[model samples]
Target: MKYFTVALLAARGAASPPPPLPAAVALNSRKCRRSWWCRRRALGGAAGGGRMALLYRATRLKDRADTHVFTFVVTRSATREPDRDVTSKDFCCSHQRWAVAFSRTDASLGVYLVWRGACEGMRVYVDFTFTLLSRDHFTANEGFSGKQVRFSAGCAAQGRGRCITLAELTAKFADARGEFQLELTMSKVRTLYSCELRAPRLDTPPIAFAGFDWSVSASGGNKEPLTLRLVRLSGEGQRCRVRYALALGEGERRLHSGPLECVCDPEGRTPPWNPRPPSRILHKGVRLTVELVWARALAELAVSAAGRAATCYDRDKQAWALRCDTHSETVRLHMLYRDVHNVPRNHLRYVSWSAWLVRASPAPGEADADELPGAPFEHYYAQESADEGLMMETALRVEDISRAGCAFLHAGGELRVRLEWGDTYLLFQATYHVYDDLCRLHAHQMRREITALQAENYSLERQLFSYQKSLAYAQAQAGEPVGAEGTGRRSPAERSLSTDTEYA
Candidate 1:
């Protein structure tokens, strides 16, 4: 039986020699011959003696593919040198050139699949497997697999850096010609929907992808941290995952966020990304690359109005006034921007503004305010020359504001405003307070003024204390009395000045 196992191992092209039979199998030879089950067990023991090379081959064969097979060989001379890379000849797959690369660093073997096609700012999604084939080509000694791995200009290769050790490859996987063989099987190779924009406009025209039109927009000026957003222009009830990579300014300093991942909802919009470390300023002509990695259909989402109505404070009417058509049902909110600069007769100033309306707690007895059919929105006005005398006005809308639990009359509402001009950025926030009449408004203003005066008075008191300490220190150093007659008491004129300072 041991000789038969050796013969089988030799026929299967196993590199290792067969082992001796176990004592139990040797002693039970008569019983093994008497029963079919015993005979089968003896044969299994024989196969195990040969290291089960047939089973190994079967398992490796299950993973091997006939198509997109790229073979790379590491020559003996190359394996002797550490830090040597032996790459295979280019082969075409998915209409692009791909090759297998084998590298040796110290004593470790690294395997990678290299992309040699024209980059053109594209990202490829590929499913691949790498197998270190044995000398006989019937079994794999080591393997690595990757699923949905991304390959782009920045990342042109994907695989395992430590697929196998050099000593193990030399001992087990090297062929009779004294070379290590590696096989790569690639499948499901496809290009993702990618787009690049240079010096993007406020709203770029829609580009079609996967039966949907998508557009990108840029906000924030050259001095501000740039914000980029993706908006679906045509498709409805669709969802997708996107990856965005940004390079700011002419130097192309990549954002540390790397490939920012965003999930776009059925509304076809992704949350705006303001790459952090606010010190990274976005210049006017930056580059942005976006790729749609995955997408799927979603259930229908509720339709809402997309129109914006302009509103401003009317000086003559003493109330908020909408400047655009009010008949639109979507006109549920208004934003007013008061210009800080006064304009001369024919002069104009460029000031960019952005505002957000954050809803507060629901009104009394209203529990479903958050569920009321309204979408959060932001108002943005670009930097264009405008008369400084005119109040900068923009508006946003929310659906079903008149519904129960959706009234804006309650307190706790917050209006956040951002103003940018040249290299300056200013942020102002105001909390909503309800006033029933003009008298209450006037009282509120007076109370605010009193609070400001109190703050000023406290600051003045601190300054006076500091000044008194310095004067006393100087007098003491000069051997003079800090106060009148060294009694630590101020004279009548000093007392009067202190009293006046306290009141002021």
Candidate 2:
């Protein structure tokens, strides 16, 4: 009897559910203002309501040594307590920089851009200006020593990673007169900018490699030298083609390579090929590898993955992380590797900025620990974070997709590079600094070797995949199997690899 009565009541409840979402309710109206905050409060909600994710807390030690500009921005992160001191620990890899923010009391929406180094040495003068006509949209440009950089912005509503580079950053709208009405915290996204300059350390080399490589890529601390190197190009003076890569910790990785052609070959006019650059350069502990390969057209590339994690490589399949461009004669690759660390907790000791060299005066609008004036732990000086770092700001304009995670300017070590083109040697001067990660960042042409090797590796991996796939397809049509285990396959390398990774 009781069950029958309960069933009757349940049927009555279903007959009358909540009224249809006000068919055509006016937005920004008080009639439904109470529910507005309730609806969009979690994901990038309006001001005061905007969140500074746990991983992106402010550097709250209180500035004294120098008046460094500080901003509040939050990069998307998985961690919540980012402000906890992470002394001597590795920096977070998921996001290398801080997502800057501006408070409601703030009057401007720009980087505080604090300069910090031991003893206050380098002079920093920023003259670039940007206009935020509306949310997720900005436009600006700057010229540094004849080099022009671009700026761009895009709405995340379209989707994540849909970025607009420097040119596109400022090209979207021309009517952005002044600033748009932004809810101090909500509309103020974690913004970054890049400017062209004469300093080498301030900018990344045209090519680079990131993450862990058997052949460690060099780091660029402080200001880098004007020239870079291609390690040992002992191609026997042969017109050889190879590749390289660039990494910027957490952003994008770029792989670029060209014919390191020795016009006057000592051995012969045409050589077989240069010892292939390493495949390690093509990876950063991740699965994506930017490969620049020169086929009949240009280089080609692709992100690699299979069994377990995305980057797990399979020697048996001859599968590696990398891609290639179709229009170039050379290939360079950077395997998006597993990022280790780099987070806000890494910067807790910076109480004051030395005159200029040692520390930075916390500037408002500046958010990333790498951008602020802080010492790299006690031994190294980790400058240039994903959100901060003057040189990092410069690279932003170039849209250098590579080395977005691995490139940075230090403040303590001497940044330098050595290059050799058949004994025609050249040396470049680079200011240096120790990174919080304890890895050495090279400041010279040494950057080329790693980048080049990664590119070559990606190219080789691609060829191997194409070859195997085609052969397998052809065999299948011919009623043949693939691989051992009655699969029927060839290639000693593939069989040797112990993992079950797929080239696809």
Candidate 3:
């Protein structure tokens, strides 16, 4: 009978009891008749600015012998103000500022947790929400969701962590407001573990391109649509929050949306918005451009992921390259002429560029447009792959007009000028030869005019001399006219004859 009693006590101790309720939760249950409403109030929303009353929580597990104590920490913070300024402190953006970290001694087992918060690099106006994780992996919204908070302690090598949707978690436990309360129950068997709260580093942030606009019309400077996207590039496990503003001359105009949260995956993107761009966006005087900003914590992660030798931009004999490690390969886009303007230069009117990906670099002087990759429009890419992968060549042409003269870089290293003229499409390849021919023709025409002018001058000189001699002879004849026998005066002739007879 005594042995039986000992076995009964051992069995009672072995059977795990339900974990006790947290202290604040216990007080709330007693103070408020409507526990659900009280819990909802604690978890604030956009109407309340999604302010978090607590930042961390801890609870003992029922299976105490098998699992360690679980600790939750707030690594980042954010709040949503909806129509007000994000900086108003009333709401710091739940997406940018709110991130919860769940840590335990043995994370390999079940009990996957999913927590969501504001993400950087996205606008605040867009709709975004996150949820927590649960043990069930097969059910929808039960396992891991892609939304991850940075600066958490876990086995990051597992790559994507498990998560659950907000709808699945009880309202008492899930909240967007950055608030927390952990209840501690004294236990001799369980060891006390402290949770660390880390403030994200803000000094050096990830570098994002000054935002690029798609389909900027060349004619009226109009933009077609606004699609914002970014890649993690070199930052693995980096946390980034991106925001943009339009630069109006006097002051900046900001459009706030849900911040984009980055997880070093290549697929981070901002919500798409196609609203007619602000009238002032294209105004010549506004100088409006989209500006991108991020947090320093993200920058540090990207640097660590890229290693010491990696560079964002590099150049070599084959091509000038822009590197974003998120891409899969390296490519070469060879310019044709040495004198052609560098990238970012204004392309000439009506100039068209056709690009191709070739397995092998074309031989010197072997480039031809007809053999280029089909559907050149599809080849326009923002980023290239990350291998010694492909050589991209651009076939440049100018059309929509009768004639054109332009210069572009070629695969070979030389300055080239192409001239297309006349209805028949005569092409002149070399500028020097064309200019030389023009000079020769001009010289020939000048020589012919010189010869003709010299001959006319000689004829005029001969005619002037003859006219002068005739005048002199006529004057001499007039001087000798008084003694002439053929004179009109017959008496003079008779007088001359009498004079002659007297003289004889």
Report the error of model 3 at residue 251, Å.
Answer: 15
Q: Pairing residues by index, what is the TM-score of model 1? A: 0.28
lDDT of candidate 1 over 1-504, digit per residue (tens):
242344354445533322221223211132422242233234442223221111000011223331455444345534653322234444445445565544445667655566665354566778888776654324234697888777765556566556677778878776554555455677766654334344435555564444356676777765666677778787554444454444333344555445666657768788876766552223334445555433322221111222233333221111122222235544432333333323222222222222223244544675422321222222322232331222333243434443445443223222222211111111111112121122244456667777888878677766777777788789989998656555877754455456555542
Q: Of the candidates numbered 1 and 2, which has the greater TM-score value?
A: 1
TM-score of each: 0.28, 0.17, 0.19
Candidate 1 wrong stretches, greater than 4 Å: 1-67, 118-120, 136-140, 196-504
TM-score of 2: 0.17
Clash counts for all predictions: 0, 121, 61
Best by TM-score: 1
Q: After superposition, how far is residue 460 of candidate 1 from its true place, in Å?
A: 98
lDDT of 2 at 238: 24
Better of 1 and 3 by TM-score: 1
- Which should have the higher lDDT, number 2 or number 3? 3
Poorest lDDT segment (10 consecutive residues) of candidate 2: 418-427
Arranged by lDDT with the best first, the candidates are 1, 3, 2
Residue 234 in model 3: lDDT: 42
